[model samples]
Target: MKITDMTSECIGKCLNYLSFDDLLRAAISNKKLNNAANLIYEQKYRSKRVEMHILSRLHSNYFMTENRFCFYSLRTSFQFLFCFGRQVNEIHISYIPRYVIPGENGVQNENNVELTHRAIDYANDYCAESLRTIKFTRIQDASRYMKRPFINLENLEFYDCNFTDLVEYNLLNALFPKVQKLVLKTINKNLDQPCTLKFIEGRFAHLKSLHIESNSYSKFHHADEYCILKGNLVTAFRLNPQLKELDLDLFVNCHVFQSNDVLLVINYLQNLDSLSLAIDDTFCSLLDSSVPPLMYFRNLKKFSLNMQLSTESRAIQFTSHQLDTFELHGVDRFTNYEYEFLEKHPTITKLILRGGHFERLNLSRIAAALPILEQLMIFDHFKLKIEEIVPHWSKFQSLKLLCFFHTKIVKDSDLKPLLINGWHGRFCNSPNKFQIILKR
Candidate 1:
């Protein structure tokens, strides 16, 4: 079929794979392509993309030779807003630089604030019913722009807020209480001031996934004063205990003085399907306990442990039907325990070890231990070897991806078992066997 005769729907689906600039270029020259690109952009309106869209307006230096009727290239944005604004799924407000009038040179502060507020007004008037996500990136003051919250907003994200004044959850909740997926990253707060919001039974009625973190690991913000993880989490936990996918590791310390606190938080959410947390001190108190508390996560199918310190436990062991995906990140000294634990969990389909104990991480043993293991990823420093289990190379019956990233291999010859007898990395003797990946 000729490209011109193709339906706009098909052309729009094709645009999904292309980058933004490419998509616009592909759409502008062709009539069908233009319609298709416009239709697709309505659905994929992520805030990051919105921010770029704003900048593209200001710094779009090259003179345009394409069709002026095109949605993005229209003479003025009002043409697109009047026609398609209501269909867009997200509203983006990223502290945009206001328009420079025909005669103006530099930015006018009063004009910019009015312009920013006008965009918010446009969102509140047109996209109120459809807008489900609103993202604020490095927004210092939202008072001028945040005139009203979209009642239907389901996701809200605040990124790089550590560089600006922190927005209290109470005020944010009042704005987006029904948000299901909320991400608060790198938020700088004053711990000395007392919180004014009274306890509410369930402030977040629709919350399902919550990611609250302190500053990103750039400077570590090293001082305790900058840490948000040390605060009282009792109110937030009690209010949103039903969250299914929880990642609080952002700043909560799970080390020397805060180990019990971490365990207590986990114990409260026994029904979580996935949990990701960070550890500061050690893994001994929890992993070395007579009864590892992590095992008690009966409903937890996926667990990611980000260890800031070394994993000092001797051996790890757990046998559960529900527990499958396990990821351990950090410098680990306990390979014997990982081996023991892997052998016990046949249900584990995805395993990621960011920190592996050298020499003891036997690929042959892992192939033998995990029967249904589909994806295996290793990162950082690691030494892997394949020993007696080489003879049973076909043991990797259901294996798929075995990846090694940034891992230093001590003995290269130990990998010979994978090549011998045309084994092809000692994979399953099937057409759909796993691939052994070696990455720097």
Candidate 2:
């Protein structure tokens, strides 16, 4: 039958199976095919295309001309958004010039400021209506333009952005009144004071997840910085008591946070289901002290710690019965205290260990303790002889997923038994085959 004789349903079904590039090519073959391609493109292809178009312009100076729309500059990119922004669900603004020349006392230059203001205006006017997620990186004051509430925005992220003044902070709170997920990375070292959430109480009532990271590695060198960060965290938790997940990495190093401060924060986070703390202090003291028991985290299902605890504090016990996932880091050796702690969490089915010194005996101990563990991830910096450790696999009958990151395999033949079922980096042994992943 001739192509024109095919029904529209048949054409659409055939076009749906074609790859995007192939559909574009097929569109030019005939008028019938062109109409079919356009129908499919409008329904399934347009949104992703617009998102990529906007991202490409923001990340690079590359330009593309399509359908009489030219995206040669940042201005034209906004113009593209003005027409098709509804198709874009997420927006990322990588860098906004500070408009201040170095060595000029940080005074704002009128010319550059005008350019930034115009870009911000275009972004706000065109894209804010439909964006669900917005990320800003290296922006001097993104809150200046984002002061208005974004009705549709649910996820917001800021990396190396300045909120130096109360006005900026207030604007930020107003910008995403309905945000459910927020990620903040404080890396600007020039700020006189660290960002704090003391003024925004009851503002993030709907927020469910919060992640704060101190991208400034140098901040750990100063003791006072940790105090400031801890204060900020306390205030943040108080303001968002409804949060279900909290991840904090303030670049804290040994002896930064006292045992009391850590317990205080944990007490406030009873509602959290997942908690990741990267404070570089010893949890041993907290466990040994009269502070509330680990049972304070009643609802916590997943816990991650990247700290060093004294092996001397062997009396520590974790009684969070609901916890199913446990992650430990910065452990060079598996001491008796550590083993004792894991012995209490026999219900844990997922475990991740990083920067840990793991020997055959340690693996055997973990397998014996967490017999039902289904997923295991080990990120070791030191070289590991997988050949010598393969014999231990028999102990992990419940393990279904095993992953290794940044670990050097001493021998390639060690993976031969696991790879027998599949050569594509995935292997299954038999009735209870498990997947193994090794990353260098």
lDDT score of residue 72 within candidate 1:
23
Top candidate on TM-score is: 2
Instruction: Give the TM-scores of the predictions, in the order they appear.
Output: 0.63, 0.70
TM-score computed on alpha carbons, candidate 1 = 0.63
Q: On residues 31-56, what C-alpha lDDT tens digit does candidate 2 reach at each position?
A: 78777776886687454423221222
* Model 1: lowest-lDDT 10 consecutive positions: 65-74
What lDDT would each prediction earn against the true structure? 0.55, 0.63
TM-score of 2: 0.70
